[model samples]
Target: MAILRRQFAAALAVTGLGVGLAGCAVSQDRAGSTPVGVADSLYWNGPILTMNDAQPQVEAVAVRAGRIVAAGTRADVARWQGSTTQVVDLQGRTLIPGFVDPHSHLGGVGLQAIAANLLPPPDGPNTGIAQLQETLRRYINTSPDVRELQVAFGFGYDDSQLSERRHPTRDELDAVSTTLPIVAIHQSGHFAALNSKALERAGITAQTPDPQGGVIRRRAGSREPDGVLEENAYFGALQHLMPRLTVEQSVGWLEKSQALYLQFGYTTVQDGRADPGGVDTAIAAAKMGKLKVDVVSYPDILTMGEGRFMQGPYYSRNYQQHFRIGGVKLTLDGSPQGKTAWLTQPYLQPPAGQPASYAGYGVMSNAQATAQIEKAFANNWQILVHANGDAAIDQMIQGVQAARARYDSAGTLQDRRPVLIHGQTLRRDQVDKIKALGIFPSLFPMHTYYWGDWHRSSVLGDPRAQNISPTGWVLAQGMRFTTHHDAPVVLPSSIRVLDATVNRTTRSGQVLGPEHRVSPWIALQAMTLWPAWQHFEAEHKGSIEVGKLADLVVLSGNPLTVPHAQLIDLKVLQTIKEGVVVYQAP
Candidate 1:
């Protein structure tokens, strides 16, 4: 892998070319010197939200060699325009910095695209258990990939959204296919429902004990397997059932995934928890020039550890062919909507067959979590931990506190920028500690739209549900945090993210937490500027500023001026990465 990385770098140096639109040239440097060429593109006559506090708005912007050379009034930007420049008239649309994904799985998004979409309303057609089964059957019969893989796989089925108000059982999936091993993943990505064949193939029997930090759910009052696997159990079974994809297949998924992001106006995306195969796929795709947007992958620290790949040339802030390994990801708990997040307080309504005291469970022991965190600190690697519940958040906070105490004198702890991903159940007290520890909060406020009603009634209950994703609390502490879609949990729709962050409205039309609502401007900053800083790329990629990469998005409506309720109606007209139009809405 080291040799391969070195060769990739050498090839990039030899090519002396930039990853830009055809017939255009861009410098690889973030803030490169002026090229001899005239402006490649000149954009004006639109609302430009710079996201740069120094210059919150601009009238015109000029792009030369993929960097913003001029951004100000029309006269100032027109200075760089030439006969060859492509003058773009925005025609009253809104132009803003391209969306940056703070925490999401790029590869998983691709997988979600190819898998049978078992999601509910507004995303997929899986309205009930019967619909989910029928969808899988259709995929098995029609998708060549499924036929080739010989396993019927589906994703994004939320029991809470289904008409039946429950997960499809082993027998239910058997109706789809008894011979083929079928796997249906929960929308949370924390659980899986496998058919009987899949269980048999995975060697999961009625006698199989639940794995540590995971659960193999049983039939009502019986030891018989019920086809549901939670947390580690689901992860392990998935590893066994999922077939390895060919390089071509992996590249195809990468292409499709980025296209999805482009349509959503995201130019800088993330592969939040990449495995070895995922890293390899990304590298191969980069070498093939398959990546259009900036892809920053954070390999799983617990499994991948500080291997040679972690120490490779790709592990830097700079992009190598539009891809780089930003840091490492640590998942301390499961999803809150799945009722699997490790919470301090007992769940208001636990999963079936569980005690009233159930508050889910942690993925690892406190000692284990601290050791992993300390190791990252010792290695000077920025860590992003997925902690949704307050108990999990507590574990992360205590772990960081311990590591900081040990590494502070050595200077390894300074400006490390540790991130807390998906702080859905984060307590107000924990917010202060996070701010004090300098741990960046990359929150998931979109939950207010997708699962707020479920949370209010079943998961966290009333006041606690209202506090999920708590953006207002972070602001009260004078801290900045980023918001995310956690794509595949839902589509990577930046508009939906903005709407949920700004409105905090539930599916039932009630405001889940009016106190936690933020202005659209603040939401935009969280998506663009704050997330870029979280990934340590704020110097060049986040806002629209001179000497920064010309990464911008065009929207049909100005988010700042649009009626608050109509925010979700805003459409992505175009997505530009480094001055190149990657996606223009049809």
Candidate 2:
């Protein structure tokens, strides 16, 4: 999707590009070019979305060093053009501020890339076990590089879709690989199906009891555990059997992931959960100056041990240009669709014949979760908790409130904007409380499209299902919000999330909840500016204005002008960060 010249012309007029540039250039040139010791970079002939209300549009932007020097018309920036300056002509493309993904698991995404690739369930109808097995066989056989540990991904096996309406058991996975261990991660990332060998390798057996905050599905007649592992149980068991990648290997995968982010027009990414190794890898990349995209690493608070270096004022000034230790991430609950998320009320319907009374709750105890939050708060670290269900949200709110009360009494409550990531199923009453606490909600609205149908039937039922993201409701409550794809959890594409937000259409082409749908403008802000605010980088990034970082994405069409469904198809022509062209389409 090449940028069309017509779009630029429209933006040029709105931005007063020609007039502003001509005036600025004449004024600057008359004053003589004094060596300011700062190099200049200029981008011209493009439609620029400033994201700033005072000056909403611009035709060109000039950058000095790494900050925007001026934003106006092509002529206005021409005066800054010197022999040492780097100039890029966007040729009438639509340029908007670079996207900031508020929530993403960078290491998980890299791991998925290293794992097997399986075909997703067919678009129209469900492919039964026989068909699915054949497809899996083909993928395994064709991809010879996928060795004995034949772990394949991308299986969207909803219960209703299957004739048996049950999770594929260890016996079924044995058909694929007996000697080698195999694990098929569900789309929701909350559940995973492991083969018998894989389970045995992790020392899980028929006598093994379910761990707290996690479940191991068991057969009805026998005490033998089914292959299905839910929540932390799945992660815990899998962590044992999974092969560990070396630091170099991890860095390679991260580099590949960063390239993909750049292709999608992201300049900054918040690593939603970072293990110690992952944090080390990020630091290594930053130190070597190999990181192309800006990174904010949020270390996983769950793994912190006593007397260990936990929270950080650990700033590397040399790497500060592209990397920062932003905060700590704590996952309080799992996904709602997976039925593992702790909710205030029981699920609408139990899985198949299971009694409604048997619906599960969140994995972590309230005390344990609260302690983690309090410790992070005490250490002056920003906290981002992943809480999806209303019950989980309630717990999170309680934790935040308690922490605030404790800190305030000691006169140590500096305004820390602790965020609740994926507050998807929050209750109406909790909305005001979130605003009052200054706790930002990073809404995962993309779920409305990906699992809307499943949610309508199995998970949330009808009433609460429609209120999933509640973008409109959140706005009405005056709560700040940011939206994300949670990359690798899904593909990291803001366009897809925007399409889902505006269109509200399911994979089956049905619009689920029209009431919760937000306008294009609001959706755009949630992806761009709101995310910057969540990360406390609003002052430097998020918007296009003087003194801000020059990070922008040039597109083929104005997202506002395009039809809702067409937003996903809009092409990115170029991506610029710190006034340098980071990516450009041929």
Best model per TM-score: 1
Best candidate (score: lDDT): 1
lDDT of 2 by residue, 1-586 (tens): 0122432233334322231222112111111234333336566666778877788788777788778888886555555655545455555567789988899977667666655543245332344656555655665666543563345443444444556656678888779878777777765677888888889888899888888888888877777878888887897896787666666666887888888788888999878778777887887777777788898878888765541434344432123647777778888888777777877777877765367774457757888888888887787778899999888888898899888887756655467789988887887888988888878889888887777887898788877888888887898886668889887767777778888878788868878778878887778888888899888888888988888888888888888777877887888766778877687665
Which run of 10 residues does model 2 get worst, by summed lDDT? Answer: 22-31
Residue 472 shift from truth in candidate 2, angstroms: 0.7
Q: Tens digit of lDDT per residue, candidate 1, span 1-586? A: 3432342233234321233222222222211223334787766667999999899999978898899998897656655655555656566788999999997899898888889999998888878898887888889989998878888889999999998878889989888889999999999999999999999989999899999889999998888988999999998898889888899988998888889999999999999889888999999999999999999999999668446668888999899999999889999999888999999999999988889999999999999999999988988889999999999999999999999998887545498899999999989999999998999998998999999999999999989999999999999999999999998789999999999999999888999889999999999999999999999899998899999999999899999998999998999988889988889776
State, as a TM-score between 0 and 1, how close model 2 is to the true structure. 0.88
User: After superposition, which runs of candidate 2 have C-alpha atoms over 4 Å from their true positions?
Assistant: 1-40, 84-86, 119-135, 142-145, 148-166, 307-321, 409-413
Q: Report how far residue 358 has shifted in candidate 2, in Å.
A: 4.1
| Structure candidate 1, residue pairs in collision | none
Report, for every candidate in turn, its global Cα lDDT versus the true structure. 0.87, 0.73
